[model samples]
Target: MSSTTRTTCQSECLCDCNRPGAACQDPRFVGGGDGITFYFHGKKGQDFCIVSDSNLRINARFIGKRNQNMKRDFTWVQSLGILFDTHNLFIGAKNTSIWEDSNDRLSLGFNGEPIHLLDGEGTKWESMTSPSVTITRLLDTNSVEVEVEGNFKIKATVVPITEKDSRVHNYGITQEDCFSHLDLSFKFYALSGQVNGVLGQTYASNYVSKVKMGVVMPVLGGEKEFSSSSLFGTDCAVARFSGQFTEGNSLENLEYGNLNCSSGMNGRGVVCKR
Candidate 1:
């Protein structure tokens, strides 16, 4: 058994929730590649697109509880479904009634097959199929990094909403469940200017944030535009995925050796040349 901690975007990567292109507590997102933070309160038990580009798609399933005092549910990202070049990857936090720091609660699957990694920090697994992908454990348990060469890197950590959180935010967390969720940070290597989704749109060259800035907590509204029928669906109104791979596609043509990378506040690092 691995014990759980309260993972925050700030602790995981170079770019965190306070910076840009990260998603954290209660579903706050920092996007626009300009550090504009906003809240996207997609309905509980629903799936929403976080990134939808021509060659890549990422969706999140939200889980939450309702408070009679509030008009909407208090939600958190429960899992991530990633689709790329005909492959599907799933990462999620397994539901637990009690959290222990030494107990592992992370669940992962690649192409519909369960992924089991040896319990140890720095343990890694790489895909055996085409289009190389890898997952590395950043800690002994509950924290890992998923990376697809020439595509994207995602850091996901499983966390729980503590009783202190419930008391402070009135989350009403009960003994039955602590509402484990994910704290995530992303780094995209070759996103197109036409990319669209909650976080993907901010990477577009012509993106203009719809969030109302300068507020303590800005909320982004567009549930219908970002909603998907399922965790792996790419049918959001603003989706740009074609769901088809052809010869000479960007994934096949990307120069793996010529990439120029630089550290930035937007993501893990900026790929100057892709």
Candidate 2:
């Protein structure tokens, strides 16, 4: 994903002309690839989400300074947040550090609702009901993977970035939002014909061409948000499905790889049939 993104981003940015080769700022992908693309360099103290075709938006936001009174400095990650139709879930984690975790089920909801982070036999997290998915932590690493079983998988890794404190902030870092971002990767196990999000919206489009440049950049000129939480990116998220989120949880793929998330029994909210 990074390789393809680099090639594509270089082709289209405001700093480029029809010239053969030149370097521009790091690219922020708003659309591309197998129904998936993410702005891994999410601003610190600013809220954002990595949207999927499931009409689902997953947010690992940071909360530190208010947008009205902010600076161009690094902000701490205060929560692991989630958003669906409306409701939000924020799990508490280390606010000072970006590469760590807090504990089991320390979270709150936007609607003041109660949410739980069920530990799946010490492997991953399975707590959502509708449009079920699994959150798996990569062992011996500072990253987590979210998967809709045989449907799709997303991995978000926090990479420590440092500079000489120059005023120039690339990777979408501006005065109000200058902090760490993510090293993101995505792979789909099975294609859910119905989809949403940037990738899903432009997966194989004729009107929106990736070769043209600006066509792929996600146009999100709207209000932004933020949260703070632990290492479990999508695992410790709050889900509000208008429909009943039910399925059988077999959890066959316990490691960090492609999984065959098949259902043998049916129930609501991460049900595992034994």
Candidate 3:
């Protein structure tokens, strides 16, 4: 362990490696151009605060990986992933069938209109405000598109990959700890005043699941959607996006094509079809 203890063990994995103070994984700046990043999840790895940034980006996980597959984690029965927000995308899932609906399925998109909040949709849209995420436009809306599953007809964009430009914290997010206590509560967002939750907003603290824990998000990196691929192919293709061109957030001139992802019995998502 030379070279100054290997740069103090990657600055103690960006400050504070034994779990203490001042090393919340280093990027705590939070302003325009954005900051805040932390991860070390799954299987008793603990420490979470996925992200909250400018142009918006967050992850508990829908994070996929199939090509060059050295490693990647966190899909956690789908729970609390705020989305690549620029024009809007919010997701939360976890109700595989506690007799069909034990309540925990909130999916969203406004500029690409497709909001599905299963389990009584929060008591029929209790607090989704912004006229309940309203945005409507279609004159063939440039001939709307959707198609997925290897025959990937892609016009794909999943916005907000922050952390001063993430690569997924250069391999430091492992996944585990949705035993519930993120204190994530979002209401009425169309642009919820440009939500600077750093990347996904769950900033409340006083965690007590594993007997006292503290880590205030910083040092995150993770790739996105298509290019840098995390190709999903188990339940197969169902990509969804509604409408946003002149300004939805980020994603300009994206295109890819190959088709065969319109399945039956309704049990697949991430769809795009025309």
Candidate 4:
């Protein structure tokens, strides 16, 4: 069974890592509804649930390097696996030895098939299946917007660790791999009050944070609760997914040419105006 709801395009609906309800560099997360910031350092090479609603489930795969001086690994979100209804979408950054902004490192897959788009801004791909999904390139390379109609929209940008970052953070990054990763922003239209996950809990009406405030680096520790078996798994302890399609599953007829997209401040994300 399928459900439908009407949704509009609004600016405030966008949620970037710099804003509330985002997970960005080093896996730092800003609350969904609350204005709290915290870090979740799940084990390296592990997958964890970031968002789990009644109909939508999103998991992130962490990639990291063990710092010789630090106790824990320094992790970043390397890829995302999104499950809605019976479809699966995968977005990831391919590892590269030499970082080049001119080359595309963003990798995309739907269901089990690879997705390829043209090399230009405004290039897009639309799924022919029900619960329409659209992926649009916001830049000439390595930046895209994945929208599931009224359900949600995710803006993903592929990035690499710079030499300065490695030097300052003591990442011990080598020339073998640049460790390409993603910086993501999200916008969700219809989410249930029962939503739960690393970022989803903040959307609950009765949610209360347990994170310590006024600290140098407030961290949210729930590795067991948010751990998933795989990138596409919805078996996390706080998972609320039912593997069913909910309301607002229709496709929007957006004019790609009308989209005005620009890099956010500090080149953090892509902001689009319709």
Candidate whose lDDT is highest? 1
**What's the lDDT for candidate 2?**
0.33
Any runs in candidate 1 off by more than 4 Å, and if so which? Answer: 1-4, 7-9, 12-15, 243-274
Two-way lDDT contest, 1 vs 4, winner: 1
1-274 per-residue lDDT for model 2 (tens digits):
1111111222221222111111112213323332112222345455543333233444444433223433332333344444433444444332222222222223333334554435333366654554465555553233455555454455443332232222232223233323333434444443233322322333322314223322332223212222224222332122222322224322222123222222211110011111
TM-score of each: 0.85, 0.40, 0.24, 0.83
* lDDT for each residue of candidate 3 in 82-166, tens digit (9 for 90 to 100): 3332333433332221111122223444445565433321123222443323221111111111221111111111112122212
lDDT of 4 by residue, 95-128 (tens): 8877866788999999999998889988989998
Candidate 2 has what TM-score? 0.40
Q: Per-prediction RMSD in angstroms?
A: 6.4, 14.7, 20.4, 9.6
Alpha carbon deviation, residue 34, candidate 3 (Å) = 26
Off by over 4 Å in 3: 1-53, 61-77, 83-90, 95-129, 132-250, 259-274
Best by TM-score: 1
Candidate lDDT scores, in order, read: 0.77, 0.33, 0.24, 0.75
Ranking by lDDT: 1, 4, 2, 3
* lDDT value, candidate 4, whole model: 0.75
Kindly give the stretch of ten consecutive residues in candidate 3 with the minimal lDDT sum: 136-145
